[model samples]
Target: MKNILVLCTGNSCRSQIAHGYINHFLKGRNVAVYSAGIETHGINPGAAAIMKEDGISIDHHTSNHVDEYSHINFDYIITVCDHANENCPYIPSKNALRLHHNFYDPSKLEGTEDEKHTAFLKAREEIKAYFKDFVSEYFRG
Candidate 1:
């Protein structure tokens, strides 16, 4: 099985959402998806809530620092935010393919609860579309 890592400035939102979709779409495939942050910022409630609405549960996931997975060999390392893509530390995965996508961080949205929900929904849909295509192109049998 191939191991994939989705990274972000904080493992709270975008990356977490990507992790959920990638894993969900690739289930029973030859891929294992994990996510982490340059610095752990705790799992964002908005991320979890939005994912649940899509019938995916990420409530069991915890915010993790990228360093925590330094020991594992990753087949792919994907950065879901610009900060993580630019400031990512060196990970010693021999043939790891690095990819980047700047997903909007819904946790950063401010305003009424409805506005925040809309932001999270938009971000979630974007993530779902991107990763769905990614899996079809790269991991489909």
Candidate 2:
């Protein structure tokens, strides 16, 4: 089994979005996807709502701290935001391949409901595209 961890400043948004997409894309494959943050900010409601729009459900996902998975050796450690990438703690996984991409935080936007929704929609699509390419390249069967 392959283990992958997604990291972010807060596991609430971008990391959670990536987690959902990785799981969706790798379903039935021998892969386990986990996401965490430098600080737990709880799962973002906007992230869940946006994922649901694409027929992916992340409602059951939770915000978690990076230390929680210290024991598990991850095959990939992915940082989804600049903050987490730069500030990421050292994971003891000897061979974990690290990947980083700074996705814009849609949750930080303060705007009218429609605008906020649009922001989330855009982020979701970008994340979705990224992970789709990632899965194809790394998990091709």
lDDT of 2 by residue, 1-141 (tens): 999999999899999999999999999999999999999999899999999988999999989999999999999999999999999999999789999999999999999999999999999999999999999999998
Determine which window of 10 residues in candidate 2 has minimal summed lDDT. Answer: 93-102
Alpha-carbon RMSD, each predicted model: 0.7, 0.5
Model 2 misplaced regions, further than 4 Å = none
Q: What tens-digit string does per-residue lDDT give for candidate 1 at 1-141?
A: 899999999899999999999989988887778899999989899999999999999999999999999999999899999999999999999999898889888898889999999999999999999999988887868
Q: For model 1, which pairs clash?
A: none
Assess each prediction's global lDDT (C-alpha) against the native: 0.93, 0.95
Task: Mark the regions of model 1 whose C-alpha exceeds 4 Å error after superposition.
Answer: none
- Range of the 10 consecutive residues with the lowest summed lDDT in candidate 1: 25-34
